[model samples]
Target: MKDFSDFFRNPHVWDREIVAVGGDLSSERLLYAYKNGIFPWSDQPILWYCLDPRGIFDLSKLHISKRVKRKINQKRYTITIDRAFEQVMRCCSHRPDEETWITELFIKGYTEFHKLGYAHSIEVWDEDGKLGGGVYGVAIGNFFAGESMFSFTPDFGKIGLFHLFEILKKDQFTLFDTQQLNIVTLGLGAYQISKKEYLRRLESAVGTGKKWTPPRVVF
Candidate 1:
């Protein structure tokens, strides 16, 4: 395993070009880089970032609507963590006719992270155990970097998120970094801050060292 810190020591990966040397994506590498507040987003071959403010959700401050709450209470689906990670990522890849940085390389990397116990996923499965929707990302210390999510059914994505929130908040997470904010996320209680401000909060969150333990399985 390559030392991920080395990738950003030069910080060349964040340069955001389609260069050839960006190499492969793996969990060991992301786990190392995530601890340092860096992620690889590539359109083709090279990785780069927009270097703007980041959008985040304070786990302690999650705002769940009565509507979403009722939906969750209905228990229309079964939710679990770290199950069907690749499937969730693949579904998220084909979102709303949008082209994303998520690619074969992205799946390969996060999958590797999943195996390494650094990356985790939240899964929403129907009664038949077929995948409904889910989200995946890297968790280093107390900060969870929410990579992406998707839903084939209405509110599936939001339910998956709310379930994840219950676990993270119960475990005392300091923050949930959503990377970037979108209209959907704004409705889910996400807010934006400058990258510098993000780093400051990141520092505070990481230092707190929160531990998350999922709920006991009903089965």
Candidate 2:
């Protein structure tokens, strides 16, 4: 197995978008990938994407609309962490408007990652105890790389995201990686930077040695 460092140390594959196709989703490989800013995307031939101009959330600039602020202040939903990771992944995989890329193989890989404490989920529950929405991702050092998110009700995903920011903030995490930019993420103040800049920040973040455990407060 060619390690990630080998890819970077080499000249040819260093400039490529798809890092390695046949690498196993073992804990070692997955952790190595995240540490180097690479992540598997659910595509044919199993590509690992590390796009230039990576999308990221600036903690100080995260936007919360008045309506969302009202919803959060109303406290109609409860927030929990890592209590329902598989359930959250399933929810994120089955959306109505799009064909989900979260394949069975992807789930199996990430499930193992979760059991190893390298991945996590933030879930929101309605007042009636129903699953409202959630987000999940992998964490390394002071950095978090969000993989996917889904909402079962209006604004529930946003609620989950809000609490996630709170957790990250309280934990002194340095980076909140969104992987890619979208209308929703851009609206929430996520911005793009060149892959070079991202790597520089990522290097600093991974050296922080921050643990991936969930924060203490859960509501």
Candidate 3:
């Protein structure tokens, strides 16, 4: 991997959300981009963005509603890590109303990252042993970037997120980057931090050498 680290240091890079464009989604490039507070937002041309007011879930501040808690206690679905990574990505991309960026190229790239143990998924399985919903992302040391999530059952996606939060908290993860805020994430207690602060945290978090381990069944 070439040292494109200096690319981010250019003064003009901070003036916009998209600092660069046109790059292959190779594991090395992806790792480098993410480590520097950047992520690929689309394909064809492959837009890379580093947004200001970055969104994140501070595990300590996560808010789980009583209704959601009740659902978790019911244990209607079983949760596992990295059990169906690519399947989860496919589901995330299949949203009927929204345009998706998880194209085949991005899927192939992240899948390779999964094979190398940097990318992972949390799956929610129904009683019939089918994927009900899930979330997937990339992790380096203690830093985790939640790429996307999807659900086929009511609140199953949020259930997967709650479980993911539990694991991150338990495993001592330092950063949980959601990239941008949306209604779903905001309801889950996600908040924004300045880009400068985010990069500062990312620097420390990415080198903490914290490994992500599968959570033991808590239900």
Candidate 4:
């Protein structure tokens, strides 16, 4: 793996969102990038970004609508963590509308990260014992960077997000970086913060050395 430990030393990269380009998605590189609030957004040359307005979930203010709450109460789907990780990524990649950034390289890289215990997935299974949907991301210390989520059934992905929030809050995680905001995330109470504020929070969150342990099965 290339040594990107000093990749941010040039100060100039700080002002631009696309800080660097052209690097292999080695596990080491991914860890370093995420720890510093940078993430790869595109392939080909591999565009890495540290957006000025970073999207994040305010854990304390996560909104669970009554409808979603009722769905949770029904217990129609089973929730488990760090299960079906690669499958979750593949599901996220197969979006029907827009193009997806989850390339083959991303799958290979994040899967290796998952194997190393640095990445995780929250899976939702239907009553028939099939994958309905799930979310996946990387975790360093108390900070979790959610990469993507997908759903095959209505509100299935949201159920996974709710469970993920519970796990993070239970573990006393300090940061939940979503990277970009979408209507789904916005409805779930995601908001944007300046990069300056985000980096400050990221530094504190990463240095806390907190461990994330999955909760007991949620039915």
Clashes of 2: 0
What lDDT score belongs to each candidate, Candidate 1 first? 0.71, 0.83, 0.85, 0.85
Q: How many Å off is the CA of 3 in candidate 3?
A: 1.9
lDDT of 4 by residue, 55-94 (tens): 9998788888898799989998789887788999999999
Sort by TM-score, best first.
Answer: 4, 3, 2, 1
Models 1 onward score TM values of: 0.83, 0.92, 0.93, 0.93
What's the TM for model 4? Answer: 0.93
Over the stretch 1-219, how does candidate 3's per-residue lDDT look in tens digits?
456765544322477888877868888788788878899999979888888889998988878888878998999889988878899999999978888999999899999988877889999998898998889998888999999989898788889998888788877788999999999889889999988889889999989444466653434
lDDT of 1 at 50: 31
Report how far off residue 61 is in candidate 4 (Å). 1.7
lDDT for model 2 comes to: 0.83
Which parts of model 4 are misplaced by more than 4 Å?
1-3, 6-13, 208-211
For model 3, what is the error of residue 25's alpha carbon versus the real structure, in angstroms, after optimal superposition? 0.5
Writing each residue's lDDT as its tens digit, candidate 2 over 1-219 gives 235675433222377666667666777778878888888887565677787779999877789899999999999888999989999999999977888879888888899989988899999999899999999999888898888888889989999998898888888788889988999998999999888888889988887444588963487
Give the count of colliding residue pairs in each prediction: 4, 0, 0, 0
Which model, 2 or 4, shows the larger TM-score?
Answer: 4
Better of 1 and 3 by TM-score: 3
